[model samples]
Target: MEGVSFPPLSRFAVCCGTHGNEMTGVYMYRHLQKQKVENITVTTILSNPRAVDACKRYIDIDLNRCFTNALLCTAITDSSPYELRRAQEIDAEVGPKGSDEAVDLLCDLHNTTSNMGLCVMYNSSDCVAMHIFKHLKSKITSVPVRAICSDEPISEGYALDSVGKHGLSLEVGPQPNGVVRADNFNVITEAFNHIIEWLQQFNSGATFEGGVEDVYKMTEKVDYPRDLNTNEITAAVHPQLQDNDFKLLRTGDPIFLSFDGETLRHKGRELYPFFVNECAYYEKKVAFILGEKVTVAFPSISVTKN
Candidate 1:
């Protein structure tokens, strides 16, 4: 996907430290905002300054989760959650959800505590997104371009990326919360730079394109085993699956181990599981997200984001 850059292309780079403790995005945004790229114009934002300052995930609500159209249209006031008003401010800055000021592409930076080394998430089956991941997979090490498709039928407004035209959220992890790993930080920087260079090339009349890619699109969100009476999580992620993100699991594979001696097994078809036992998702009851790998053939077939 390497090509000579010519003219500039305008885009937006928003690093929402919505979960402020996820420092990969925060630190990378700080670095990239300082160094400017030519021809490829960008509007970078540190989405949650206060949360980052407190060294916590969020103040009231997750800022990234406050972007649904209904929420965006709401009037901000002193009574509202900090994230609610902050979302409104950010929507105005880079995007008022489809206005002229809205960036052509939105790059939301994120990180996870799971062993998910590098995951690229997009709204739908966007060919442009596929092409970007294809190029990135070939370049990044330790992990390939594992893509997550957040296909929303209606405006969920639960993420910062949902407010833009064409956008992708870059999640890099296995690092803990509230701290920066130089190695992880370096990978994040490299991935973003690669995308920027690729975008410049594409806008400059180069087709940094790919034909097809095998991406694991999220099919269902699996919650941890909970005690029905007390609603407390009763089981934990199986030892076999720990740090085994992106590995294909077949029918009857161990997925969870109960507090007692029983083991919970997967009974469905072969599937790929990532974000296995993510710490932040514990509150949401998401033990892990179950996904299926599908071939995304580009150019030949037109796949819309809707």
Candidate 2:
């Protein structure tokens, strides 16, 4: 494939605290506020101040899910949800989504209760995000680095990062809500440093050699078994499957254990599971998500000199 060139990424945004209780990003956003970089404008935002202040996942709705074009274009009113209003404000600052004035790159930070370590999530069509994922995977040796691709267009993406011309979510995990684990925090910090280094190199006209990468493409969400009468969860993630993100689940593999001491087995074709037993996903009715591992090829890319 021929090399692809993109205009120099001059503006960047690092957004965190979209979930409020995800402490790694909240603190990282604070740390980044005091730092400066050369050649690029780095705008750091604490995405949801009120939610962060309360240490809650969100004020009214999940801010991470409020950036779809429809939501961003919605007319704000007194009855609008707090997060909806904040999403519009954020779009005005770093986005205006799908416009030329949007930031060159936007990276949103998040933490998960599941044991997915140092994962980058982005739309599969984003070559820049894919390259950044490859760079971070190659550079960060302290923890496992992986990428999850949502095979969709950026216009349909709902995450905060989707507002930028190129966007990705830097998600690290096994950390609980409202708490900061030192190891997880350090991993995220190192990732940001590497991302900045990559930006500097790309802006300086370095060509990045890209190749095939194995990524997990999100397929479906699995919810916990609920009681019919009370509509309450009746099963929990099996011990064998808990904290085992990225493990393949085959037919007959144990997935859930009912309160009555019955083991529930997987019934479908084999697929890798991620975000296993996530805390926040409980409310979202997602026990975990299943994905298929597939290899994607990206072309070498360089910054287009003006």
Candidate 3:
């Protein structure tokens, strides 16, 4: 494939606090609000301010899940949920999504209780996002940088970043909710610094050489073992699987350890696992997500000269 040129990414948004307890983003939003970059119209947003004030993930529903077109276009009513209303308000600010008025790029900051390092997540095979991931992989050496493609269509994307023309989420962790670890915080700081640098270079017409890179495409989610009658979790992630995000899991490998001391093994073909035992996923009923690792090829990209 030939190199691709995209319009300069002028209007950019860095959003945080989509999940209120993810303190890294909550604080990063405040940190970034003080900084500025030349030529880029930076819009810093503290998404879900009420959730941040209360230090809860959300009040009525997950704000991150409220961005689907069906939900965003729904009419506001006297009893609309707080997050749905907030989503609309945010869409009005940075989005009104899938329109030309949306920001050129949006990076949503998030933290996880799982041990995944610095992971960049996107909904599609966007060249600009791929280039940004490639640049971050080169610049940020403190932690492993990886990319995950959820493969959802933009209009159906449920996250805040989906509001932009080009969007990705910077998710880092092993940090506990409501607590900020200096190490994790520094990783996010360095990442944003590098992202800003990449943007500046791209806007200046720098042609980034692209090649094949490994990306994990999310396949399916695994839920915790539960009692049929009680509807309560009956087992925990096996010690072997705990904190082992991105490890390949083979059929017959231990996946869960029951309270009664019996071990449960994996039952399917081999695949990589991520978000293993996420703290927030307890409510979502996801023990972890499995993904298929595949190499993706991208073309060299540069800002189209006006």
lDDT scores of the candidates, listed in order: 0.77, 0.94, 0.91
Tens digit of lDDT per residue, candidate 1, span 148-234? 776674255468876666677888888888878987888878887888877776665664544667777888888988899999989
RMSD over all Cα atoms, model 2 = 0.8
**Pairs of colliding residues, candidate 2:** none
TM-score of 2: 0.98
Q: Rank the candidates by TM-score, best first.
A: 2, 3, 1
TM of each candidate vs. truth: 0.90, 0.98, 0.98
The number of the candidate with the highest lDDT is: 2
Instruction: Write down the worst ten-residue block by lDDT for model 3.
Output: 123-132
Ten contiguous residues minimizing lDDT sum, candidate 2? 30-39
Cα lDDT, model 2, residue 129: 95
- Residue range 93-187, candidate 2, lDDT tens digits: 99899999999999999999999999999999999999999999999988899999998878899999999999999889999999999999899
* Error at 120, model 2, angstroms: 0.2
After superposition, which runs of candidate 2 have C-alpha atoms over 4 Å from their true positions?
A: none
Instruction: Report how far off residue 207 is in candidate 1 (Å).
Output: 2.0
